[model samples]
Target: MRFDPQPASYRPDPAILPLAPWLGDPVEAATFPRHDLRFRNDRWARAVGLAELSDAAWVDHFGRFAPLSDNLPQPLALRYHGHQFRVYNPEIGDGRGFLFAQLRDGDDRLLDLGTKGSGRTPWSRTADGRLTLKGAVREILATEMLEALGVYTSKTFSVVETGEELVRGDEPSPTRSAVMTRLSHGHIRIGTFQRLLVLEERDHTQRLVDYCLEHFPGPTPPEDAPDRDNPAVRLLHQVVERLADLAASWMVAGFVHGVLNTDNMNISGESFDYGPWRFLPKWEPGFTAAYFDQQGLYAFARQPEAVQWNLGQLAIALRPLCDAKPLVAALDRFGPLYTAALAKRWCWRLGVAPRGEDADARLVSACERAMREDGSQPDAFFHRHRGGRNANDELAEALQGYAAVEDEAEYWSDDRPETMVIEEVERIWAAIDRHDDWTALTGKIAAIRRMGAAHGEPPVPVGHIRRDRT
Candidate 1:
């Protein structure tokens, strides 16, 4: 493939370095035993102007952790504290991953190339910094499927098998090892701001807020918002808006993120760090993704509450910079925003034109009732009743006057829609682990993309730069 020579292509912009010692620490990549390039996202590569690299070059950068030209001279392990399971922990940070590179995408949106299993940093504590090959494979599947399902998520840009045997309590011991790279909108988390708050670094917190507002532009705060022009208030407003929609998107896609901690919650509102995530088999409210989540803290139906709570933590973090009243007001907007977003996204998945919020809400409720009563999986339910074609009494009434978005895509004619439940994921991984086959993974990706095409363009994420929604 020919590399695009446009200036926007390969534009390395390491914007985080200026935040220096206070933000993170410079670190070295681990010396791996071998480098085997496994998965390369050529589609996103072309979008970011890295499509021209050969397999060897790809491994050199992602596996060996070589610095991208014009990017950071070395990897920087970010520092942030988060509330893990409602308990505040100041010890956690980027123990396993670091920001490898930063650049703009084709749309001029800033993106970060961050690594998982690259190496240990100052935050390594008592854990190995390497990722299991199975973990890498799971992330690839999670990102691909979530993207197709219209969830704003980090893209698994590249995966390289680092020849190493690692032991873990959760998986089989001495399993295969690999390093995966995530291409995301930004790596700034609510915990990033929380770190500053803990240190009593008011100026640094304000600077970080300014950086986020400038880099990830969002809609201006409402005219009635207290301190609407204040950087801290504006940033809070933006994050609240994006995350409300994010929660709704996940709900519509039948996804349970499993963890919604402050550090895991990206400031840009894109979902990342897919650990123990799952899609619903049917409409089960208490379904949890992580096996250890015994309390069902981040269950399927409770995701929106988890997100709203995280946003509240962010507001707490920002109190040092702005008045608490304005931040509280911004946080209060989450409910309305989430309600509207759920209606819109739910309608999108059903392939019906959305009416006003009240009508759309009724349609969503009816569909959920039908699925729960019929014991139908979400993937099957949506596909079987697209445009209200096969709806029952309640759902049919709710779908009245809602014209279907015109599309002749063959995926719409399929007997069943593609799903990424645990069984299918394990089966795909079994093929890769036993026979060293990648066809199953590749084929599933292709099918998922076709499904996304039939759904058309996803709604533009809030706070993202305006562009063609179609």
Candidate 2:
């Protein structure tokens, strides 16, 4: 690993440390028994200029937790408080993971290198701070599929299998262990602000607002915003727009995040921390991803509601820095914004140019009704009707005058669309577990990317400013 030549062209930026000590606690990484490289995301690695790192160097920094130059000197377990399943938990923070490093991509956008299953932190409570190999594999699959479906999500950068047998109640006994690194736009969550509010750190909260505004630049505040120029109000409005789009994307993609806690809601609006997530196998509104979510708080159809509730929590957290009226006004935009996003995304998925709002919504309703009547999965339904083909009755009438986005694509001719349902995920995991084979997993990722390419570019998310340097 030649550090002088900088083969990776790394641009390390310790962007989070300025809010540190109070923001998080420096912690040591756990000593793993082995550092066997299992997975490497060369695509994203190259995007961030880390593709040149030797496998040994990759393991040294990510698996062994060596600090990158000009990055964080040590892993910092970020402090946060979140409402877990609607119950406030002040003891929670970075239990099994920490922000490892921050850097810039080719576009000069700040990116975070965060870890999962790295080690125990102050927030570990009584649970072991380790991730099962199965868990890591699932996250890789989740991020890849979600990204392909155009959700702003984290990238699973690396997965190093540690030779440690772990016991997990959720899975089989003596499961394999591994540490996974995620590449994301930012690590600041709504819960980050919640922690500051609980501690009455108004000044620090204001600073955080400013930092987010500068780092994750978004659209200007609404003209009717009570305090259009106020940083706090602007941040709230931006978050509302992003999360609304996020919720719509998930709904249209037929994906369930499973966990929609306040901590899981990132300020930058990128989705991360995939635990027990699932893509819809059928158009079941009550379909759930996590077995523990028996109450269906974050169910398939309830995700939008859950997101709105979480945004309300963020508004409460920001109350110390801004007037409640402005925050409430920002929050009220969610319903209309989400409806528009749903229509836009629904049309995009169907590979047709969107019609007027009413027509698009009618088309979406007809499509959903058709799915329910036929009991078809989203993958089958979307593929069967791409470019407005194979439609009749309400769907056909609603799709009138909608032009196809493209004349033809090779993927459209395929017999079946790629899907990431639980059965397929388990099949890939089973190959790795029983036969130590990775071909199935890699093949699925490739196919997912191809499907995404066939769909063409997704709708640009609202409130996200393009920051790439030309």
Candidate 3:
């Protein structure tokens, strides 16, 4: 648990592009000699076998910003552009970040590892490449927590604080600097593909489609493989599926991304960039954490819709690659996929069988009504510690009561918790008393409570929860 402060060798990969004429001079830095960061705790990192990368010799061989000489990633800097919130921004891509090149672990799968705020690049338009320490810290926290919660996300490899200085409007005085690196499947974004397509460069678009299909591989199910010469149709379907699944995950977790801009949407569909994200303390469809989301474009409950909108942009970007019919078909799957995903996740959260065909639609609509009148707080919540009752039964009853109470009261607000809140939860479950199967459901519920009450030592990973069915 102690901080290891001994001096250590440091280095960066020298095989990198020099600063463009417009960019500022590069100031060199290194990861603190000791793997002093919390997430990279010498122990946990070792458990993950990342400790091998922590070795100083390996650092020289692998890290671009590691202390010592200049050993860096194989290929660096991906060139691309994006539309920021629907506005064209011709200049974008790793302005303060660089892909140090992909690295293979024991599995032989190459992981695209990269550093953020590692000094400036040609794209460093009007900004410093130095990242504020706090920004890096927040990113680490977000990644670790998300992974533990069962969401696929980028993982923080390391963060080395540059004891020196930089100024930023968002933080306190001259901010401390740090370089944060993330392990991702790849950095290709919807914007990366869209940028060239916007330039009307068909040849480049074709190449981009090939690259994405080979790497990101969107949703082309086996039977509907795209025409080989026609990679666009393939790429279109792939992205649509990934995007739908990603939206569903966000919905299940009650997360508001705050920004659903195309530039932030990755082709691989993994959620990246945690800026301005907030998890709902309790479910409320209307709540948004991103301060700039004035229009609620990326509201808590509208995430699926927001992602679909971003996918529509991708649809435009890839339009050159596919026929109109297939493109239409790919886009059409978004709604159903998102709905199905939501139900699957909701069912898991409640520990019950998925519902009747109309159940999901009705629940969502009911929540909409309750959100308006009952102060959008969730009628029921997920218990991470399992062994509780069947979630569906408990929640359905609670919601039924809550809605009845709201209707009887004849007035409501989505932002407030009223006298009816607790009453309704209790009122709704009374029906469980009549069911012959209630005993079994109640046993599961009681089991969940028993699990919750046991020593509150942190849970083992959900993957460890029970691979075998109960």
TM-score of each: 0.97, 0.97, 0.69
lDDT of 1 by residue, 12-114 (tens): 8888888967898999998999998889988778767898999988989999988888889999999999998888999999999999999977667778999
Tell me the tens digit of each residue's lDDT in model 3 across 198-257: 678777777666655654533344476435245776676667777776687677656667
Q: Which of the predicted structures, 1 or 3, would earn the higher TM-score when compared with the native?
A: 1
What lDDT tens digits, residue by residue, belong to model 2 across residues 351-400? 89998899888999999999999999998999999999999988898889
Pairs clashing in candidate 2?
none
2 or 3, which is superior by TM-score? Answer: 2
For model 2, the superposed segments whose C-alpha errors exceed 4 Å read 1-8, 465-470
- lDDT of each model, Cα atoms only? 0.88, 0.88, 0.54
Model 2 lDDT, residue 175, Cα? 88
Model 1: ten consecutive residues of lowest lDDT: 1-10
Once fitted onto the true fold, the runs of candidate 3 whose alpha carbons sit more than 4 angstroms away are: 1-50, 55-75, 105-108, 217-219, 222-229, 355-357, 360-380, 384-394, 398-470
